[model samples]
Target: MPVTAVDTDTDDLTMTLVGDFPAPAGRLWRAFTDPRQLERFWGPPGWPATFTQFDFTVGGRARYEMTSPHGEKSRGAWEFLRIDPENGFEVLDGFVDEEGNLTDELPTMRMTFAFTDTAEGSRLTNTTYFESAEALEQVVAMGAVEGSTMALDQLTAVLSDLRAYAEGKGTRTELISDQHVRITRLIDGPRELVWRAHTEPELMRQWMLGPDGWRMTVCEMDASPGGRYRFAWAPEEGVAGEPFGFDGETLLAERPRRMVTTEHMTDTDYPSTTNDLSLYEEDGATLITTLIEYPDKETRDAVLATGMTDGMEASYARMERVLLG
Candidate 1:
């Protein structure tokens, strides 16, 4: 299923998800309300949630950990504002570090979750509010809304399995699908120039979002097997008029072409966005095809729908400039 989100200039943001679940409404409601209930259904089917604290009523708070297969982790928390039985609920969700320090960048604003009766099954609508335009843009780039859709899709199956288990049927294993990304680009420069743009720290920073303080603190790449690399790029703060370096990565080097990397942007609303970039030469130039293979399609589309394509194209243009400069 393709996951999607809204991109508009308004105070209200709404997302709707619908699926046919074998389990009843009450069961689904419990899956979301009870902390123990949530832990059972959170994360991608395999990556379970480790709940610290959870309360379903208004003003309640919950923290969770979703661990990836490679031992990487992404944490998030939500502040409950309302929980109206089986009909609906509302809360604000944002990023949290290992120590749970809420970053100054983003926070849980306000969100309303409504459950409706669909002919086939249930429809879930998640409406959110952001502090401003930039705030909305920030989270959109990080693929927040869409990831939840996949999480919930998995929830649907979880409920199905629970229903089957209740009926003495075997457990469900269809939810273990692998996620990946494919980024195909047509750069204006030659293959060597394209390679240099990504390999050189300063050049990578110019196009990629370098470190926050005009620094490339972690852009090391041996470009070989058994080699590891981490790339960081962000715009410097307090600059009168400077482009921001927003997205960066820590990559597992597979050399000369492919690598598994993590893209980190400040939104922190979602856990993590993993990417696999495959580079090759086409007609003397480079065709860098990147497979973003996100853990979920919703996260993929959420970030893609947010003009990420435009920004990345622009970033590539910047790479061209860096090469020419």
Candidate 2:
């Protein structure tokens, strides 16, 4: 197990777990920041977690559900209190209802996760501050210590698979749920330039084009919260595909790091998809992850059947070529 110790202090009304990992602090940071990587080990062995919503910013909230082997579920939410990139973060952790609302079923706690370099690798000091000694005892009695230890132990496998999320892996798509799909691409460019390539019209047209025969004909972007944007693509004169476009209104914009938008096909009454896009940089390269929530399984399947990931890979490959140049 990666966890070295689990200590409960009634005097301080807290529970602390210490874990040592072979990966560096940055890798650990990404594991926590990326929902896809995080879900891999956040829950205990039998109860796997799925983050339905992860904003990952100060004041932001993350909602997740850990489903048991027999379909029972435990929902939880984290209200981010402070974030210190690659070092630590503090959150108000609590249980939630099926609709994602906080509930009183379990005691809420303030948890702090601190990361530091160790002789062999990195160490994570995770301390949970309970409201009272009774709360600490309550959690312990519920097996929080054992559950957390097993969860942390699963991180070893996730950290060992470095190449799976490294740069040059090209565009990858994962069906996170029946209605949610996550797409990731590590671009060989800084976060600023990558963000610009996505927001700036001239830069966007240069790489957002999918496949060799098509070109972006319209690239209109507002890029501010609540602002609307539109994009259209047309096949080169001889190419056979029909022209297409998408329009969306930004829901949140956190500058070079995160953006949330509601997207819909232009001129269509189809329900919109909430696209949560996040960027993380490591070793000077930026990884772009977009979690798209479709209306239903049918819509998700229809979109995937349309060769979305293949087109995305082509566009992302083009992005590296143009952005790096």
Candidate 3:
């Protein structure tokens, strides 16, 4: 997890937040500049954001809205004043109405974000200067502190996903057959690294744990065609229900290219499945295709209904962090 520290200096009419992420400055910089990435994490949890306008040049403007769980929308805008690659930028941030008109009643502030390299990773410091101490207090009273903290946390997750995609780990899924689900990802790293991450247990442990709060307690892999492998996952802390896992045997093994395996859950209603993974190189990026065949169409449909794709994509994003590291 990233560390976020927020400070408010009423005398200076400013609010400052400093955080550190285990990623490069360039990666973190994208989270701020890229519209797609910014929309994903610009708001706090339960209030997903959407960016309609993002012009990242000097004097450019951006308009976005964050929707709350209760179906309320809070719109905002930013006028860019400066742009610096891998370093930071300055913007005028303010509130807007549903019609995208700036709200005169709200206090607009000037925000500057600075990014720099650090021993741990990348350090981001944001200073928001208001016109007066009263203006600073106005935003703070509106839960700015908590909201910004949550937004930064979302930014960290976005950074992880972006890094993976940037490294050629972007993924897309399709249903090719009644019983098969195929997932394809472009990996920016070498095919060898992708192969090792899939075949090596130690490396697999770094990214295969389904989602956050889960850990692989058992990771056994035999890369040979006839070899068997088993992976068990449990909650980091004890949960209300029993832990679950899967085991399989390699059906085909082609180093740095392809592998076929059979997988079955240990304690679940889901049926067994077969996974065929093929890797190729295109323009120096590794293209990985994972085809999963379930026992039946019903089984495949059931898994998909459980939002399995989101979990798989999230896991792969975590894998990108491991590869980058």
The most accurate candidate by TM-score is 2
Which segments of model 1 are wrong by more than 4 Å? 1-23, 45-47, 161-325
Q: Estimate each model's TM-score.
A: 0.48, 0.60, 0.52
Report lDDT (Cα) of residue 196, candidate 3: 93
Q: lDDT of candidate 1? A: 0.57
CA lDDT, every prediction?
A: 0.57, 0.84, 0.79
Ranking of models by lDDT? 2, 3, 1
- Per model, state how many residue pairs clash: 20, 0, 4
Estimate, for each residue in 82-149, the C-alpha lDDT of model 2 and write its tens digit: 99988999999999999988887689999999988878889999999999888888889999998999
TM-score computed on alpha carbons, candidate 1: 0.48
How high is the lDDT of residue 71 in model 2?
46
The parts of candidate 3 lying over 4 Å away from their true place are 162-325
